[model samples]
Target: VAIMGRNKKTLDEAKSKLGNGAVAHQGDVTKFDDLDALYAKVDDKLGKIDVLVVNAGGLTAAPFDQVDEAIFDSMSDLNFKGAFFTIQKALPFLNDGASIILIASIAQSLGFPGMSVYGATKAAVRSLSRTLSAELADRGIRVNTISPGPVETPIYGRIGVPESQIDGMKDQFREKPLLKRFGEASEIGTVAVFLASSDSSFIVGEEIIVDGGIVNI
Candidate 1:
């Protein structure tokens, strides 16, 4: 497995932790040249890839009034445009029968306060999966989106949610989701593994929501 991110330290640590010939490259996903370089390295080292996961994205929580051109561009560039080119540039390196998974968010369906821009970005990701699935169907490529709801990650703090509140945030996070609890990263990983493997061979252009039943409610 290979990982690419802007943080060299994080990438190195992840590579070290996932020591099964995993490699890490530092690059900004929003840059095409960086993505090209990353893929060049992949092509030279791993040749054709069977599974590609595009998890490069960001989230913002602010009222619609706060949505400005800069905010829109930043979010769209990273979440939508980045995902688009990440796959476009990887087309050559991707194996014909491979699976591509995109990490989206429950924000796509949720009407949470201050989530207009973020939600719209994820909605684009969800829509891309469908169109890409049809566009690549003849090539045997599967494109799907995974919408994770309130997963346990360090992102909340980055989003300016105070740690004190984060501790008890889950209880009042949302009133839906039959599971009544936040999801674990590993749970999402398990589902991703299933989607990437032949087990989901028949599944295509579909969304596998990993949000503890958030949208279903």
Candidate 2:
């Protein structure tokens, strides 16, 4: 396993926790050249990539009128453009029957007031999963997406809402979900593991929504 990110500290921690099975490379997903270099290094060491989880993303929430071009472009470029190219560039290095899992979001299908741009980017990711799955079918590469809602990640603090307003936003979902709680990152990770393994070999171009029934209701 290889971890890609701009944060050296986080990468170091991942390297330590994942041990010999993991290698840490500092690179930005949006930059194809950087990703290419990382892939080169990994290929030189590991020979071939059997699984890829395009898990890098960001979220920016603001009123439609308040969203600026810079903000919209930043989110779209990182979430959509970055993710699309990451898979495209990794094609040569991926094994013949590799599994590719994209981390998407339930917001892609729902209209959350301030999440328009963020949701649009995630929607693009979901679409990319289907199209890429078809494109890579001849090679037996499996492409699928996992959509999680209200995951308890540090990202929620960066939702462009006032710190004081975040608790209220989180509280609103408590009773609305069938699970009656937010999801943990580990929950998403487990779904990703299944998708990456042969257990999900027959699944392709599918979006498994693990949102605690948020969108189902």
lDDT of 1 by residue, 76-122 (tens): 99999999999999998888999999999988987877778888989
Clashes (candidate 2): 0
Instruction: Single out the weakest 10-residue window by summed lDDT for candidate 2.
Output: 156-165
Question: What's the TM-score of every candidate structure?
Answer: 0.94, 0.97
What's the true lDDT of residue 81 in model 2?
Answer: 97
| Model number with the top TM-score | 2
Candidate 2 lDDT tens digits, 1-217: 7889988998999899999868789999888889999899889888799999999999888899999999999999899999999998899999999999999888899998898899999999999999999999999999999999888989879877998778988998787899999999999999999999999999999999998999888
Worst 10 residues of 1 by lDDT: 160-169
All-Cα superposition RMSD per candidate? 1.7, 0.9
lDDT of 2 at 33: 88
Q: Model 1 misses residue 142 by how many Å?
A: 0.8
* Local accuracy by lDDT, each model: 0.87, 0.91
